[model samples]
Target chain A: MPHVQNGWYLAAWSDEVGRTLTQRWIAGNPVCFYRLGDGTPIALEDRCPHRKFPLSLGRLDGDVLECNYHGYRFDGTGTCVGVAEQQDKPRAATRRFRLLERDGIIWIWPGDPDRADESQLPDTSWLASPNWTHVKGVLPLKARHLLLVENLLDLSHETFLHPSTIGNAAVAATPIEVTTSGPRVFFQRRMVGVQAPPFYEKSMGLTGLVDRWQDGEFHPPGVFLLNIRLAATGTEEPEGFHMKVLYGMTPSTENECLDFYALARDYAIDDAELTTFQHEQQLSVMGEDVDALEVQELMYATERRRTVESSIRSDLAALRGRRVLQKMLAAEAAEESGGAVPATR
Target chain B: MAPAARTAGDSGQRIGSPGADEEITVDVVRRRSVADDVLELTLVRPTADPLPQWTPGAHVDVLLPTGIVRQYSLCGDPGETGSWRIGVLREPAGRGGSAWLHDHAVEGTELVLRGPRNNFPLVDAERYVFVAGGVGITPVLPMVHAAERAGRPWVLWYGGRRRSSMAFLEELGGYGDRVRPRPEDESGQLDLATVLAEQEPGTLYYCCGPSGLIDAMRSRCQGMPSGSLRVERFSAVPQPAVEEPDGGIEVVCRRSGLTVAVPPGTSILDAVRQAGVDVLSSCTEGICGTCETTVLDGVPEHRDSLLTEDEQEAGDTMMICVSRALGDRLVLDL
Candidate 1:
């Protein structure tokens, strides 16, 4: 492992650990999982310090995980408690990772634990609030997580790759605007005379609009949000619109990701039906993304990276997103060498 | 991290409880379609995870990518740590979470599961009665199995529009004389009165299904002790029609300090977002409980339909989507 910088790598979803020593490989190391009786998720090295046997093969006793093979027990912090034979050994321990749960995802810092910053973790407070009806789903892609991230940053492919869903055949000619910032990238596009899909149409009604049309933004490393508005009939000051946000965090494994999304619509806040309608609509849109992304992953795995030289204005966001990611990666490398990384355009 | 900021009415405070925040990944050793539409997904992990663990009478939320988090019942043998089992019913109304499992998910799909967390777990009782309707059988199905294995006397009143819609019919038969399948009944009605009248002393009644059944059961079980009868509904209660707005209002998001004017034709959430507050929301229908936040000051017309009488009485929370302030201005915890 290339001493991953002190950043958050999604360890597991809040739904993924138990007392049973669940196993997952993140960044590169294998992690054995456990949770306290009160339901706090934790991760420790998979290899037993004693015999190198995978700790995942063990069992859990209350807050402690008991190795099945030799009957060794360890707590949430990865402190060793019992040895099969040498029960009173002074100091036998295993490497433990720092795990934090935020917005339904358990994040781990598999690097220098002291350098872990809880404040740097991504915020997902929307998932818990009742005003939002959100769903957190998973998909194991065939391609590497980095490739998937790249694909997400690239929006020009929608013209060809997702022609049937969000992309329009005629819209390919439209130019896109792209921008880049520190560890963040933005892709923007403006289209005319585009038809609204079910998700958009339904959400428009809830937002107190008649017919709604759209605009979009794709942020780097897996955050996609779109701004859609109501279609104008007579054009009387325009009704309303919304910003739907989708974020994907790929896991320790190269092909898996935890997708977090939220659809903030414009509608009467008190109308229950409108909220449910938005939820159902967002669900369908997510399904569409899953169908496309999973297949995209499969195709990338089967074929070499295709030349992406063709540039459209709308693709600016995707390009900027890529540039930002490259910058972040270079900065990380420079920091490792005790040198400041120069900012790039 | 101010202590006052973490007070009871803190809008940012976690309502999912401390337990609502856990996630566990278990390997699926075996996954089989036990019924036509029902699949028994069994997650097998080393016994290091505790056994006879927590999941009481409700479902645990499973996190799947593509932004899908679904709730499923713990149908497998709850007593065994060898595996955790759940029965998933694919609904046409599914938002890809359950549909993905039905179409794409299979055995060996590593499941990242959260608590067998029961906002609706089973409680101790002298006698137990279970009423399951359609996929609502998820939580009850396992309870019946446990009751049967433990030699506890319980009857399963399972209803479906037709026999085919009801999952685990074969399993229901295994309940023997205790199960009453209501497939033939007109509109598949469940006579909770008849069932409740025959209730034995100290009997605990459990009902899971559509709002109608739950409402019916709740009314019929009125004679039972408070909290003696439990219920789990798949969908939220129906919301009332929104009347034509009399006037526009103003919303102030406490955290972001953004204020927006919500005209009669607009929702408070929309106005707040327009002001760049960027509040997180979903299912703008007010049912999913995703946008619920603390009310700092306002008589929120209390529009959406999810909270119970108790939750509303608590008045510490309000669903921002599809709900609005009764007065001209409202302050929110955001």
Candidate 2:
């Protein structure tokens, strides 16, 4: 939870938090989720204010959650409704976080409720659009959230990390343009005449020398999107297979993250065989990233020795991503020191 | 720090993208003040390749060294293929677009430019009434010359703060009686109402000026013949207050067969990019004529300053960058 970014973060998949007291730790804080009688989702601080007992261990009686420890009951808004043997409930209440559900994902804001603006959230309609098909899963990375963010921003790692699934030698060799417009950082690369990677050739039957492009945009803290396009060489118009690879990296704890990823495409929205192949291939590719990042984090957190690292031209986007994160942290730190913002707790 | 989520995609999604624009690199051969605040620059290709031919009322997007793009009318002779000329007015209140050229554009300076796009084209007419206000005369200058070459009867009403602040007087010196200099210091405002009332059977009015003048002309034009008035605005027409939700409207691209949900924060240009259809775009600011899409149905709230009053009311086409639907559904010919 670097700098505790002040906006909506994906707490779980839309289907992951329903019909039960689902508990999820996001950015170092615990939250419990449940649905009302009408199917509207709700999230509240997991800890009971009385004895600090986890509210997720309680039972949902219609819309109120009855704490298991002292039998205290709370409504969907975390308002203490019943105190077991009393009527007033001793002014006991738990923090209620704002939640918004869209595109098969549920987002929770772990900050000031008045400042939780939904427009700051990313667009992921393709994840659930009838016009596009996707294969998605949640990867529990034993690494910080920024590790996933940097990994996605610097995609040259694909050539080494997942060479068998979606990478090629041309990836590391191709040059990319790194630019920034305010808080947004962009990495764009275009290859006019190159052999299609084996993964792409077999997965989509791409043949012959082709023109390919990789465009990346990073909106710091939680989201990263990569758009890929491929077309035959000498084609006047760029008509080809397109992909929008989306990553919703949510900080679950200080040392771990819940990385939700989905690969949505414009073509083959109705192909069942392709969906199965993509699901398996995605698991394999993401497995490689999770394994690599887990080992990297082991070295980063446990090692007594610190090693110097050198970056090349390909690190331009990653470095800019780091700079924006640092800038946000610095700005937030300044704001906190000035004592203008309300306390999160 | 508040987090913002933007799904990154093709380079065409950039705000500065001269997408599919015919870009030309030319060196400034000459720069001279044509009016009190107007500067004229002559550009020529260093390699002597003939530039693309453009008609009268055409303008080019000058990508200044500072990355600010401003459109200027091509006041030079369209017959000359080796060189191009443009007139720039230093707008004191503008966003430093014209002032950048006025201050930094020098002879021998290399610059990048795009397009000779024409939204205010000069069509054939038996008689032409050319109404130009201040530096708005740049496009009118070429139109009047084209009319003379076509042997058509044309009269130019050139109005400005004063004669010293008006451009192309020397070029109009030979066309005595046909050219009327209505400098405010001497002649008061040109009675556009009188000109509108005297619309001859075959007369077509070509007006290029500030919003006030263009609006006045548009109001007077309704009583006159339809399709008889043509206006070019130097800036965007003021849009009404935005009151849409953040969830966005649904845009269906008929030709591409792609449907996209355009959230309020995302532009229609980027939304179309999500469906893998990159509509050609230049200035996403609603001024440049690129990224214009045909509206099949649904009322489009025209936010662009490019379309004339009647064109907006007609509602056949829209600038996708800054405009959206009046309801939850919009169909576009991508």
Candidate 3:
């Protein structure tokens, strides 16, 4: 499937972009990201307008970026400000994207600049806020972005995929509520008066039945915010433990994606040992996903036409999410083609 | 300006209403291109009844044919109950909301509009200074008229990319010297420093615009009288980073009759969730104002962007998504 082109995607972490040029593919578009002298980030088409040279191979001179091939200097706005040994500055300038930094992440809009509203940026404050100590890492997956999105939206896979860490029978046993709003879909599942899973016992020290809740919100393209909560069973108390997991999946190519993961917690503020434990545990769990997804991608490629798929009740949220993405993609196509919008049922 | 009252429910529904799920549809009676890339839409109720009364800064959510809901200010006079008018700027790079409105929202088209909720209500003041940038002049248009009708001294500093791109120019022509229309093509950027230099004691400063313009006005009005500046933000304010606490704290769930030790590097939210208790939360960041939990007997370290300084000082609730307990143990209502 073709990736959505006209939305904000996580380009890189703030630390990843600096004076040195860095190149990454966003939704199959080659782009280069760099920061100016004052640390304002900029994203431009990786290919230079002149000879289609990758700008990432160029050198930075203050706010001006000089293409290594021809020494063509471009300003922060992607306007070609200088040319090598040329008396007149040419009107040739690379396409510049809207770049925004929020919560320690740099986001780039790959589509229309007129529609690049900063407010449309996904909220990832929990990962960047100081009150929550989080473990952050990037996982380059061989699977498509939509597959990763489906995996994230369907928490039922945890029982089988992450049996040692965040999995339990209750996840499959509990009923899920699938609801949608605009381009976002939400999956909420609550397992009331259920036995505390081993992960909860080891991490939270819960011994008896507990009320566990898992809520995941899916944003178009590929972004998910998961809110997990646990409390003693039969308790009306509002005081409960909670954690937020943020997933930012950026499609680097048709078959590859960069998954930015952040697991933030409200309980433990600054314990290095806990961070290490959680980080190690997550790495092991995510390693399983990475392994499984790679094989799935291979199978998808091999049996491109022979494969058949089926959906269960648990896949409702993922299915809704897919439909929302399809509609958005269709709308974008219609707008580009100047055709009538697709009819709604 | 008072914070826009945010109704939290699923989008495309009347958030606070009970059993009233149907949308209010209105007929687009007239559509005119007021300026380049700007459109003025006049809407009236499908019935003979008058539209809901709205304050000067009120805005209605217009549901477009493209399945996107956009908020547009009520620029028409409040006294005119027969119809409502809104100005929309066609943002070429936007998410298709404005473009759909500019292209498809024409005469005889029916649109669903929700709420004339005023987050930017005009306050009582002896004098006022209004500053607007580009398409942000919509909300201020009605306020200027209200100021004129009340016989209050007021001045408007409106600006856009050029003369052609600025809307409602003919409407402001009646105000003469009181309205300063600064088109960037003819004049440079608005001299905010010069306009705000003279601080009138009772003058309430109202501004609505892009972040750059708002930030300029904020810095310029720093030394002026406190509470004199009011702004309507089209985007969220950047949150300040909080320092992580050093050690784990014990949380006492009063009703659950349980005490959970939140190990270091974990949040109270994570601990509670791990314990199997679900809290209503959305943007797990402090920004969305979701996951706000009441603190029954302990001081909460507030890190959310939704609360004001005074609310933070009160220490009644904290956004669990990114906030933690201050002391070793916290007694919570949850």
TM-scores vs. true structure, each candidate = 0.42, 0.52, 0.52
Q: What share of the true interface contacts does each candidate keep?
A: 0.00, 0.00, 0.00
Candidate 3 segments whose C-alpha is farther than 4 A from its true place: A85-88, A304-307, A343-345, B1-334
Give stretches of model 1 more than 4 Å off.
Answer: A1-5, A18-20, A88-90, A117-123, A156-165, A169-174, A190-193, A202-243, A254-313, A331-345, B1-334
Clashing residue pairs, candidate 2? B237-B305
Candidate achieving higher DockQ, 1 or 3: 3
lDDT of 3 by residue, B201-320 (tens): 899988887757866776566445445666654532111111124467777777777677888878788888788776666666665444668777655666555443323434567778
lDDT of 2 by residue, A74-185 (tens): 9988989877766656678999998888878888878778887776665787787787888877888899877887898888898888888778888888988876543557
User: Where is model 2 chain B poorest over a 10-residue stretch in terms of lDDT?
Assistant: B1-10
Candidate 3: tens digits of C-alpha lDDT, residues A170-196: 888787986644356778999899877
Superposed model 2: Cα runs more than 4 Å off? A1-3, A85-88, A236-238, A339-345, B1-334
Interface RMSD list for the candidates: 22.5, 21.1, 17.3
Q: By lDDT, highest first, what's the ranking?
A: 2, 3, 1
Question: How far is B20's C-alpha from truth in model 2 (Å)?
Answer: 38
Chain B TM-score of candidate 3 stands at: 0.70
Residue B247 lDDT in model 3? 64
Evaluated at residue B258, the lDDT of candidate 2 is 90
Instruction: Per model, state how many residue pairs clash.
Output: 67, 1, 40
